[model samples]
Target: MNTVTPPKERAAAPETAPASRRSLLKRPRQLWAVTGPLVIFVVMLAIVAGLTPTFLGSNGLTFIAAAAAPILLLALGQALVLNIGSIDLSNAAIAVLGAILLAFLLAPLAAAAPLLVLLIVTLFGAVNGLLVAYAQVPSFALTLGTLGIFQAAALVLSGSTTVYVSANGEAISALYQSGILGIPMTFWIGVVLAIVLWAGLRFTRLGLAMTAIGNNESGAIFSAVRNRRVKVVVFALSGFTAGLASIAIIAQSGSASATGAGGDLLLPAITAAILGGTSISGGVANPINVIFGALTVALVPIATTAIGVDAQAQNLVYGLVIIVVVALTMARTRGAVVK
Candidate 1:
């Protein structure tokens, strides 16, 4: 009989080897996403400590906490917008307008001024969200347009001048100057807010919807997610936080200015969010991690000074850090367009 013996079945080992290797490779990336910001913060702190021993003192640490507080709020807001697959270029501008409004309303509204400012900015953000959700406007363009409008409005409202909260400044002033357990009150507020946000994002239905929409809007829609409502809420939160940050700014400076309210904060806030492991392509964010990012940014100028670098070179260093971090964390897929 010429019947050949059946070919021995191929071993399953070769087939599973590549899959196992891929699983192993994915783990490091997952770990990196969680720990990268902390690593960077520690490295930066070490460098500063090595170069300038004075930076490890109580006063320096306190200053960093206070200075980073406002940026932390702004970055938290930016992180929300980015999570929803959108960008709010107007957040910084919103802060400026809120400061102007806060300055004008404090005497008349008293303690209610901050509350009113928060409401106004939240509504302002809702409008942006409405246009993006229902009107189908691209967020980048819409926010860019609103940025110009808000800036112009601020200039007109403040008459191109700084507004001082001379009479009723005490309430706002306490936010920055007061400390609890050796930390600034402003820092405590930021920390509390971050914890609340983190809890909401981790445990709520709204957070699930946000992640879904960011991951795949069409899929989210198919899955019965109320995409528009979620977006509106997300942007409203962004605006609310911006307003909160404006209060912090006024507290720190004891006054508000059209130029200084937002100032160079927009870029730094975006950088902080990104550095904190919030994916720029959306679908992920961590308010807790973002605190470390804010601290990293606040350390930039201090780090530069500690290392004897020129002050003007700070922006260059920021640009470099942003580029490197983005390159590493950006999501990539087949046929994905850069736009």
Candidate 2:
């Protein structure tokens, strides 16, 4: 009888749940993470456009696109290496080498020049892959060594002089200076390559495996990811991109110099990759952000000149911006798991 007593009223429910709807928002830091760089980029663009009216004009736009193409291509290569927790300092050197070959060796072949350059690039990439993947050398050391070797080769080939393509060298010039649909050909090539890489990274199994290896090699190995093979492929792709970039540079300048593209390109190329939201520690990559980053870096110098800033000051500012971006990215990624 007692047990049947109205199922013992559950001790009155502890305080009733609050009735007001609770709204949640992203943390302030997270908001800044996305908006800070975007705001700065927009502001910079506005300032440049205001000071150099040409910046908003077709000619200026074309110039920007042309200038950005090589770096964007090189940055894509760098981004690939970085994604695998490696670095390729030899990109500019490879580009310079390819330019020299194009001017001296392949130039005679005319229409076949691009194919020969592509072959050379593939070879260079293969070597890098073999050494890094098979020989077990640290990427930094290996690439640095190759950088010097490639530069020396370039110098020997160019003989302390610039190799000029005839102004009317239609085929060679087309690689760099020509365009399709009112856009520079080099620019178009870069856009296409970027799209391809972005798609590969997003839609392919190899891309997923590479990302997994980059994020954690040990974990990837445990999970049966073929790390070595993937890394080799990545290095090869980087080399191919560098080679293509070299051709573009040669076309733009209508010449190849012994110094190659010069070391001036190295920092900027790396900076673009780092600033593009690609992890330096290796993981996922953002090609769209990389494109924007390359454009921003290219525009800095253009804007500086248009605004009458000294070259030295421009370099200083560029360095500062890179450092700040890297620091911010590191802070956000530290102690956080990527996958």
Predicted model with the maximum lDDT: 1
Would you list the C-alpha lDDT of every candidate in the order shown? 0.83, 0.75
**Predicted model with the maximum TM-score:** 1
Q: What digit string (tens of lDDT, one per residue) describes model 2 on residues 60-172?
A: 66777788888988899888888888889888888888877777755467767777887888689779878998898999899999999988988887787887764335676
The whole-model C-alpha lDDT of candidate 1 against the native structure comes to 0.83
Q: Relative to the unseen true structure, what is the C-alpha lDDT of residue 261 in candidate 1, on a scale of 0 to 100?
A: 53
Candidate 1's C-alpha runs over 4 A off are 1-26, 326-339
lDDT by residue (8-69, candidate 1, tens digit) is 42333356678656654676865676677888788878988888887788477787788788
The residue-level lDDT of candidate 1 at 292 comes to 85
Q: How far in Å is the alpha carbon of 320 misplaced in model 1?
A: 2.0
RMSD of 1: 7.8
